[model samples]
Target: MQPPTLSLIGTTPRMRWAWTAAGVLLIAGWVHRPASAQEPAIFRGADLKLGEELIAQHRCAQCHAEKVGGDGSAIYRPLGVINNAGLLRGMVEQCNATLNFQMFPEEVTAVAAVLNRDHYRFKD
Candidate 1:
């Protein structure tokens, strides 16, 4: 037996277009799902630009450079003691407290999210 073609199945042009559109939508949703799922809830909708600006304003790199040398990114130990996303956020909050940055909770979360995106890459 042979399979039926679109012509044999009476598929109109409009129906073909609808099927194509539905497939595209499904693919699009699938493609974007993993990224959102991987992102931590605390980091969702985080202001990356604000985080970057805050890092600069605080001279975090300069201080880290003074402490650890190089461009200061070396201070970020993605595989080191600060292992998980919660720990990463806690470390950022600890830094804020110790440095008297007085950052709000959301700001701390934003900074941690930026660090995760750039370095740590914790899926959860």
Candidate 2:
């Protein structure tokens, strides 16, 4: 026989209908996609390898996938609000703040640079 389902706090019943409703609400909150790459010289000095390592260590895709589905890449709207190098850096800062990543300035920049190379493709 199957075991009983746990609740959100581990003290209540696991309602099938409740989970479905939550999922529906999530699908209704999609954000806009940003412009991919096309940045200027500010990105010229970025370290691609370091950026890639930081992203892997932080598991950015894991979190994104959990929220937006499809391997989590859909959450990163390359052609959305982050149109330039400065904006890209700022977005990374926002993510760090929101998620309490506690990364230093260089680490944040590295992560963003890597993301730009692989996904954003912003020129610099």
Where is model 1 poorest over a 10-residue stretch in terms of lDDT? 1-10
Off by over 4 Å in 1: 1-36
Local accuracy of candidate 1 as per-residue lDDT tens digits, 1-124: 4357756644777888888899999999988786556787778899999999899999999999998999898899988999888999999999999999999999999999999999898877
CA-lDDT, candidates in order? 0.89, 0.74
Model 1: number of backbone collisions: 0
lDDT of 1: 0.89
The Cα RMSD in angstroms, rounded to one decimal, for candidate 2 relative to the true structure is 18.1
Q: Indicate which candidate wins on TM-score.
A: 1
Where is model 2 more than 4 Å wrong at Cα?
1-39
